[model samples]
Target chain A: MAHIELKNIRKSFGLVDVIKGVDLEIFSGEFMVFVGPSGCGKSTLLRLMAGLEDITSGEMSFDGTLVNALAPSRRGIAMVFQSYALYPHMTVYENMAFGMQLAKSSKEAIQERVEKAAELLQITPYLSRLPKQLSGGQRQRVAIGRAIVRDPKVFLFDEPLSNLDAALRVATRLEIAKLHHAMNSATMVYVTHDQVEAMTLADRICVLRDGLVEQVGTPLELYENPQSLFVAGFIGSPKMNFLNGEIASKFGANTIGIRSEHIEIADRDGSWKGKVVHSESLGSDSFVYVDIGMSGDPVIVRQEGTRHHNPDDAISIAPIPGKIYRFDAAGKPLKH
Target chain B: MTLDLWTITKRTAFYALVVFIVFVAVFPFYYAILTSFKSGTDLFRVTYWPVSFSWDNYISVLSTGSFPRNLLNSVFVASVTVLAALFLAITASFALSRVRFRGRSLLLMTILAVSMFPQIAVLAGLFEVIRFLGIYNTPWALIFSYTIFTLPFTVWVLTTFMRDLPIEIEEAAIVDGATPWIIIWRVFLPLLWPALVTTGLLAFIAAWNEFLFALTFTSSNATRTVPVAIALLSGGSQYEIPWGNIMAASVIVTVPLVVLVLIFQRKIISGLTAGGVKG
Candidate 1:
């Protein structure tokens, strides 16, 4: 419902700055995810946007109106905490109804909104049950339902799926995606350390490191052309293996980078030779860890399914020429 | 066979130790009740039970002595003390436990010091202050005095309970547009029922059994609490100690507290243990 803009926002606890000066703009209805490791200030950035924390310096504008002094409720935002934060003493219905009650909405309106939310969340059967009685997944739904009843301009989720088990997290993640589609007008900002959730849920992922934005781009864009080694290593699982090597040959100043999946594995005839250190088979694809002599690091090559490779096997690998990414010594991406 | 014998001996020793501890803890109260039932001459007779049963002690203690009035006084003081102490302590503890503000640690330390100061150390100064305030012989004097002993412990104990509450619940309320006050009143207070009851009961017992302040402050039957009145009931003239009337009055005063303890014994133990361990 609103585009949120943060201009040079900064925060500090005494002298220790947790959030350095950073600027970001979340367009209307965008599903923006802030992803970083623990203590990297991702959660703090989300909290700052939600008005849960004060912006020490800078301007936060909602829909082009400066809302730096606005209270969280007045800002028309709802946050679902990582803990699910359901009211243990209240039933699911009351938990969802709480915000409307505080806003002094009519009883019929509160009931209508709550029931609609409960139904949308498939939690109608659990409306009368207390939070303690519900399982973690159900409690998460109730927390989401509570946020939905507010019908705010933006929804803030602080690692909302972190507490759920693997299966439940997947289910809840899908539910959130559907919910966003249903409420297409509302802007949503989610923070998570889980890269898969970030990749799957975000319209654009904001990769952060040490209180600074490392890169902000579409998931595939960040994946295919990461600006820095930090983003390169961070965005993927079985993290992209980094091999230290001289340029050997370069076209002008461009430094080449190659991903594991693009490297060709052959029985013989390749640019690089190494003994296979390890191999992981996933049935659909396999990863071959090759120890190139004196490279001081193993290059992980992703091979197509049915490739036969094992540890201690001699192998030849080479980058699929055009697939390599080139970067400068400063880690800036260079044109091919 | 040897292992079985060793295990049997270990079990027997454990039971024996438990019995010994229980007897040591309970025997004094038992002796007090037994002494209260006996006649003055029979009190020193080295007997556990009364030789002759008599309702005369109960009758005299209830009608002719200050025991009845003092029992009523103690009830009023304890009830008022518990109500006021819990009312302020709950709110104060919630603030101390949940809120972030300047001087919060200092405020907590000051409250903790109130509970730590010996009652005897403050007796003379408090007596003068109470007299100067012109509430010396009144229930208000005892009520205020009892708060000194109850509030700090109440706040400290309830703070531990409040801290153990899930922080997310409070944050949920905040996101629901609840101000700090509403969060404390609607969310935190309801969840704190168990802690409140535990603290209130402890405060009541503390106020009810308090003797030094009550004895020093109140001189007349009108305002003297149960303990002082019971101590003063020695045949009305102090020449002969009226053991029977004392015993009957003591039994009357103690029965309610004993029953309360029995009812909430588990909770009391848990609350105390939580305080000790958490602190």
Candidate 2:
């Protein structure tokens, strides 16, 4: 395993800069995820680290050895692409054995390694089939198997689950979580625009925005104490609701942010009142959209299982005490 | 009754058009085959169908001075040209399509421009190069010149085809420690079977049919390629043409191409049309 460090890493394509200055360190055996919206340079940063793209200007070192000029193969890193990127003509066994064959490993050794990796991914049955014959999730597992047989010092995944259907994405995500635990010694860097993937799989989530690192912390750390408004908004699903004008002024801030799950429905006397505009029930949790007459869209509050709130019903909501996130004029978090 | 008549007329028209297109495309080759089987004045008679099956013309053409040798020459030239052109084109295309460098578009445009040049326009220049290389009068001359000319078309087609391959596959190969050559050989070349087959067949046909370079570069009857040898076929009188023998040679030369296309029609058609539309 290798500890990777990037200092002031920057990548530019022609006149346009994709990854501006970024500094981050990933420890050996850490599952680090670069999560951001599209065009936020998370993938680009991962590419830079994988040696797929050259760094424009930066210090990149792995295990204290500078590798800014190293080839991807030389970097001892294996990447799983979003498209699975399996050789369409190669059977699953050959696909997994390709890297080793290129490396001139013994045929017996290659067979052993390939079969082991295929077994680990539970794709042994399809080893004789070409990539075209396998389903999307199966193709992705073969890709991971291909990467695994490399016994790479660092593993890089570039949005590997985005191509699968929603159900398959979840199933594969769990598979990856198990994989990370199983291969505990290898450092892994994953990139995705999906916050749920980042939240669930990451040992530390690095939030990126427009070529800059917005925040880097554990998933809960980013959820609970996002350093800036961008992270506060980007790190959560259905978004962390914001009340900016009078409501925020009342709280002595420029904007007061609250996640829907952290907000409670008050029975009689609550901090804010609104009419229910919409609600979505997903068995485990229901999202209740309230027209609180706030600055932007209607505030959404999470109600646990089987909670029924009809549209047009008047409801009062309050943010859980001390759970409210306050930000100042610059979007930097304000001290509570 | 009127609606049924209208439908019948439209159906008749569609079938007629299809028959016309197929006949127009195939009639010449059919006539050549018909002529090849006939002897003497029967070649002159305009016949839509074969009147007789005589092996005399085939015998005469194969036994005639240097005709079979020329056939061998054409085969050698075409095969060598295809191999050389495909080798150069595949590597050139990988650079043109995948590698990002300054003047890449300019380089690709230059390749396309080279192929656009008429073969006759460069006849003298290529002749000189062939002579200077000391390969003139040898199959090497035709092979060398044909490879150069075929490269432009092959490279342009392969580049376009190669450009359509998923970039992620290349990156995956790279992560697998594939050198660009390995990526082309092991990863890319197999996926590119369609493009290769299409381009190689076209290149083979072009070289097999080439006359201008083959004639200019070779002075001996033995070294001349099939097209040139077929052109030089004559009768007892200057006014008389050995149409029967010529037809037999033509049929022989064309059989391989027709057979190749028949076998690979699906892949060739798909290769030609691939990346021309979005799925």
Candidate 3:
């Protein structure tokens, strides 16, 4: 395992910069994840670390040694592409064994390593089958197994679970968690657009936007104390509701922020009043979209399953005391 | 009842149109085969079939001094041309399809232009070069000439095939630490077998049937390909054509091609359809 450090890394395609200067430190054995919307350059940043792409500008080091000019293989990294890029012509065993064969390993060693990887991935039954013959989940396992056989210092997953169905995605997500546990010493970096995957898999999540790092912290930390509106909106599903209300009467200029789940609904006597514009019930919880008399879009309020609300119903809402976050107009959090 | 009647009429018309097209396409080859079995006089007798079938025409054509040598020369030249063209084309097409180097678009455009050019435009220049190189009357001259005609088409066809291959497979090879060369040979090339066969067979037939350059450049019987040999076959001089011998030689030259087409016709059609429809 090796610590990877990126110093002032930047990427540009012609005149358009995809990854603005960013510095990050990924500790040895950490399962760091980069999460962002499409075209935000999370995958590009991962590719830069894998050496699949040139650095363009900046220094990247592995284990305290500069590896900016090294090839992917020479850098001792294995990447599992989002497409499960298994060799179609080769059997699963051969696909896993390919790197060792290229390195001229002994036949017994190759066979042993391939079988071990297959066992870990629970793909031993598919060792003799071609990639097209396997199911999507099986092909993904083989893609991961191919990486496992290489025994690289780092493992790179570029949205590897995005292609699987929901049930399989959960099952495979668990399998990956178990695999990471089993190979606890190997550093793994994952890139995904799915916030759930990022929240579930990452030891620390790096949220990116427009080629710059928005925030980097533990999933819950980002969820609880997002430094900017981008991270606040990006880290949660149904996205954290944003209302365009200025400090009506600020407690020392602290512009208040509150998550939907933190707001309580009442018939009267609350800090804000709105008409409930929409309601979505998911059995356990419900979301009430309220058209507050504020300047912009409606605010969403997460209500308990028992709370009854309907469209166009007048409602009053207020933050549970001390649950509100205050942020400046620049969108940076301002301590209350 | 109306629907059934409509279906039957449509089916009948379709089959009728198909049969008419087949007859038009196949009658000349059928006539050539029948004529090859006739004697010299029977060829002009205006009969659909020979009164008596004989092997004499086949024997005459096969034994006529330079016919056998010319046939052998054609076989050697066409085979070498197909092999060399396919080999270079496979490598070139893979590079063009998968690599992202500068000038790739320009290179592809150049190949397409070469594929479209009329062979006659390059004939004089090529002829002088071949003569200067002193391979004018040898199989090398025909092989070299065939490459100019066939390589670009082969490359163009194979490049289209290579590009259709999934990019993920190449990425898999790269992550497995396979170099670009290994990825091309081990992964891309094996998956490209059908395309190679299709392109190689097309090149072979084109080289086999080429006449204009072959007739102009090759002087001796030792270097003549089948088309020129069949075209020049006559009774003693230009006064009378040896229809029987000519027909026999034509049938021989075409039989292998017919078999090849029949075997791979489905693949060729599908390949062409995919190339046209997808892009």
Give the winner by lDDT: 1 or 3. Answer: 3
- Candidate 3 per-residue lDDT, tens place, A170-193, comes to 999999899999999999999999
Cα distance off (Å), candidate 2, residue A322: 1.8
Which runs in model 3 stand beyond 4 Å of their true positions?
A246-255, A267-269, A304-307, B1-12, B49-51, B236-238, B266-279
Candidate 2, A272-335: lDDT as tens digits: 8889999999999999999988757999899889788889999898888888899999999999
Indicate which candidate wins on DockQ.
2
Per-model lDDT = 0.84, 0.90, 0.85
Model 2 CAPRI rating: acceptable
Rate residue B144 of model 1 by lDDT: 87
The C-alpha RMSD in Å for every predicted model, in order, reads 3.4, 2.5, 3.2
Error of 1 at B34 (Å): 4.4
For candidate 1, give fnat to 2 decimals: 0.38
Docking quality of model 1: it rates as: acceptable
- Give all TM-scores, in the order shown: 0.92, 0.95, 0.93
lDDT of 3 at A81: 84
Interface RMSD of each: 7.1, 5.2, 6.6
lDDT value, residue A266 of candidate 2? 85
Give lDDT: candidate 3, residue A151.
Answer: 97
**Which residue segments of model 1 deviate by more than 4 Å?**
A247-255, A267-270, A294-297, B1-5, B31-52, B265-279
Residue-level lDDT of model 1, residues A171-196, one tens digit each, is 99999999999999999999999999
